[model samples]
Target: MKLSVWTYEGPPHVGALRVATAMKGLHYVLHAPQGDTYADLLFTMIERRNHRPPVTYTTFQARDLGSDTANLFKTACQNAYERFQPQAMIVGASCTAELIQDDPGGMAETMGLPIPVIPLDLPSYQRKENFGADETFFQITRALARPMDKTPQITCNLIGPTALGFRHRDDITEITALLSDLGISVNVCAPYGATPQDLTRLGAAHFNVLMYPETGEAACRWMERELNLPFTKTVPIGVGATHDFVKEVATLTGVEPTLDTARLRLPWYSASVDSTYLTGKRVFLFGDGTHVATAARIARDEMGFEVAGLGCYNREMARPIRALAREYGVEALITDDYLDVEQRIETLAPELILGTQMERHIGKRLGIPCAVISAPVHVQDFPARYSPQMGIEGANVIFDTWVHPLVMGLEEHLLHMFREDFEFHDDAGASHHGHKAKPRPDPEARQPVTADEHPGTVVWLDDAERELKKVPFFVRGKARRNTESFAAEKGLSQIGIDTLYEAKAHYAR
Candidate 1:
């Protein structure tokens, strides 16, 4: 695996922790070192979960590695089963423990536990968090699912949602309400609140609804192949997707779908004359595959934003992201490096950025506005409110989350017209938000360089810098860099207003 300061997803075993934490009576015995226990903070601190994750870590140190680490793992498993008394148990090893070649699954089996023991054979170096979650959920579902003698009903099992997901709890509620409105019943929702018995009844449902493509697709595909059950792979994030999702479910169940557009305020909000300014607003998107693709569709189709650039860090889902980028006539960035994503944002200079916490920092550095839309989230992303990113309510939330960062056309025009007025800034330290501005750097400490000060460097003329300030502050730095690069390419030593305009025209093409 590649080393990075920031990663969209953690190691595969962490994914198993997510599954164990999300379920009701499931426990995970992780054969890992003490350092690997840091993943617990992700759920407790970020998700604000009241209880600790349902995991028992071996936490073997260097001293234990020299001793009988295998026996330590067995003791941990026996203690976890006795203490938790879970209905089901999962056994796995972390990257460091895997090197020791101790079979954790086999040791757990020999313990003679009464409950079902699911073995997680995840290769930490070969896969990531999403893949691990998918494999674990698929294994659990396959092991517990039973053949039924009854006919199918107008019901479905919602698959692929778990703990620490981006607004997954509310998304499930929204989707459940939408289905209920159509007189459809939900048989089960797995890996979120389902028990071992709930998994056994999965075949009782008429079909399956694959909510998040990253974690649930594998399980749904397995069920379809084994049980001959049909499934829908639509993610209901935006207005159009929600509508399509409802229609698809209706078609699958042979029932007439009923949609109350008034319940979903996004269509009306987007059609309102006040929101006309949102048309053609440039947007940059980067996240996991599911949210990034959904956000791109919503930005371009519903909100009328020009998708300047879009990509994801989940390399396993690269093919679909590349297809999406091709649809927008842009190249997809498939990498786990946050620096590459930051460089792309600098090059795009979009008005609004929809991404994760890493992109939030990058946008702040570039003076751009951003809204967190995907996972690898911070505590703030899990707000203490009923905000969701799916179904009708989710559409309204998306409209507000994405639009609040941008300056309204009329407000911006007025600001530009009266920015020089003394009333705009008072000596009392009054500003737009009534906050005091920080002290500026001393000009004498770092003097500005003139064209004659440098021998071969391309310097910005006074008029050129002044004109560049007229551009949006978020993109001013990028504009200046681009103009200077263009001057250097043409072997020019000075960048005048004419040269700036030439560069702008060249980039505009």
Candidate 2:
């Protein structure tokens, strides 16, 4: 019921089109304009799907906004149906099209087509990509659930299954392996291999497995209510979690699951111990709650790193995340306010910052080595082969990223201390940093900042940098202004160079 159902924790647009691209024998008639269709690039350039979103954009322009748009939409739909004899048709709209309220759902029903039609009411402004994904999957499941009947008891549907990240294929393989080992057969994985018949047989599965938190809840509930097919909420990420998941599934399915699948060739306990050099390495944490929670376990248990601070700009997902944060004895800083995150950086002073693309810039400015732990990851997250964050190899990846960033344990701490600007504080309670916390400023003593504080070379397109100054935070304004002023003094652009001089020199006094 929370808005998190529609809110995304990362780049809302990541790999969206990849879903459409992977699904053949499906036609997508987007109720969007020309520019909105560009989502196809995620597949063409990033995920590298051969075709685009199985789409036919309405191509409605500013001119068509006034005309019989319904007719235009009808034509597009008819043409699409003719061109692609799809098993199913997806009728969807982006943010702009939602305003027009083109009820394709009603129209598709009246058409009396041979196949099913899924109407996606994904309002871009109010929601995000992950939410759209969940809702769409939900609607599609319901759509495919028409004229439902009972099925075999052994099969099960896989919820939250989308082909997006580089590791998706491997993760699926791993899940299949573990489930197969438990004798719980997978019923459908849609758009990958599952047929319409397979989708119809979804209720036949004993239950559903939700791999990701983003798209699982709605479909799980619907299946539970309609088909009495219950589901598991655990996201099998780390070693301990995976082991726990295997046990749980074994109990649920009433099968004696052998560790033959997850327990591989290598000695698990001894090998994990082999990577103990990574323990206590100061690590910064930020990302979506789901991935962040998983990362924390991987950092502490698997990778052997000590997390300094955990924060996420994605506030919508902070609920399930807080427990995970408290486990590490740190309250997560949940805000889109980048400066606050920066302040957290100063406080935790982690040797390595594991975060999103935005943190790449912050880490560079702060002189900390970093690797992107979660999304909004660019093409770089995917290596030549499938480098997944699953199984033993995932543990290895964690070990390498956490360890390569710094030397083991206290050495990393001493390095950050020596290199960073460590100042004395009185309270010593802000965070892990032993520095004394600064006293709050008296309201009466506070004054409006003057030109003297604004001294800096104003860089072209420095609006964003300047925007950081107006943040209500007293500390952030000071730091951003100071950095800008320093750049101005050096004739570099970021902040205006010497606000006083720039003004006075322009005037004839």
Candidate 3:
């Protein structure tokens, strides 16, 4: 594998850990090297769980390679079953351990443990984290779910919501409440709060509600084919989508749709005079397929924003995102490389970015505002507050999460615009207090990065640079690029105030 500073997805075994750790009575035994144990810190530290994930690692070192590493895996599996006494166990090998070719799944089967031992054939080199999670859940469901009679009342299994999912804990609460209001009861919520025994009861539900398709679609489709259970396709993220979701549920369960949106404030807030500035704002979206698609629709249709760019890092989602991008008349970017994502953001110069934690860092470096909208997020995204990304309340949370960054960015821009004022200057300290502000580095003192360092090739004169500063900070980068391209087309070597105004008027037409 190529080495890089960041990655969108980990190897498949980590996905297996996500499913195992999210459940109540399932354990994961990973055949990996000692260094591979670092993955446990992800759930324990980032997710801030009180207990570590239910994972047992073989942790074989270099010295043990000459000897039998397979024996180490067998020992770990036996110890895991004995110590934890889980209802079921899943076994797999990490990317590094895969080179040894110990065949973890075959070894797990021969052990003949009293409890069910489901072997996971997660190919680290060929597959990724989401695929691993999907396949693992599918295998578990296929092995444990039995044919049975449906419940008397209309019920569905919330077939997704794993550990470390983007706001999955709260999404479950929101969706479950919405379903309860529609005269439907939930039979079980799998892979999150479910047990291995709950898998057997999965068939008792009349149908399933597929929340995040990336992690749950495989299992849901399998159930539809094997158990004759139908699942919902709509993801209730925004006001419009939530309404549509309720109607879809009505069609499936024969219950009249009851949309209780009295608590939703997004529609009223969006049309208010105070929010007019947000209209026509350009936004870039990059994340998982489901979030990117849902956020794009919300941004354009619900929030009155322009879709400057749209993309996803997951290759599995390329086709849908591409089609959506085509609908918006922009090329879709489908790649895992962070550098490619960063370069595209620079070219687009969107006023705001809704993406993963990686895009947050990219935004900060490029002086743009960003909000986290998908997985591969930081610890801060997992707030203690009950913020969800689905249901009626979720629309309110989305309004706040996506808009706050732009609002704060505007405040910072105003501060920069009036920095020359004695009262609002950087050294003026807190406006409400008389205390002296801390000494800050002077921007002029540092070696200025040339405008030529960016995408364009045109030079800028001192007067033109001062004139360009008058443009709002949010659109300043785009203005500069546009002026440069205009100058280049006219065969001008250097840009002046006249040229800047001329380019602006030309583009305004």
Q: Whose lDDT is greatest here?
A: 3
Q: Candidate 3's residue-wise lDDT over 226-299, tens digit each? A: 89999999988998899999999999988999988899988777778978989999999999999999999899
The clash number for model 3 is 0
lDDT of each: 0.86, 0.63, 0.90
| Cα-based RMSD of candidate 1 | 2.9
Model 1: residue 135 alpha-carbon error in angstroms:
0.3
Top candidate when judged by TM-score against the true structure: 3
Report the poorest 10 consecutive residues by lDDT, candidate 3. Answer: 440-449
- Candidates sorted by TM-score, best first: 3, 1, 2
Cα lDDT for residue 347, model 3?
89
Poorest stretch of ten by lDDT in candidate 2: 5-14
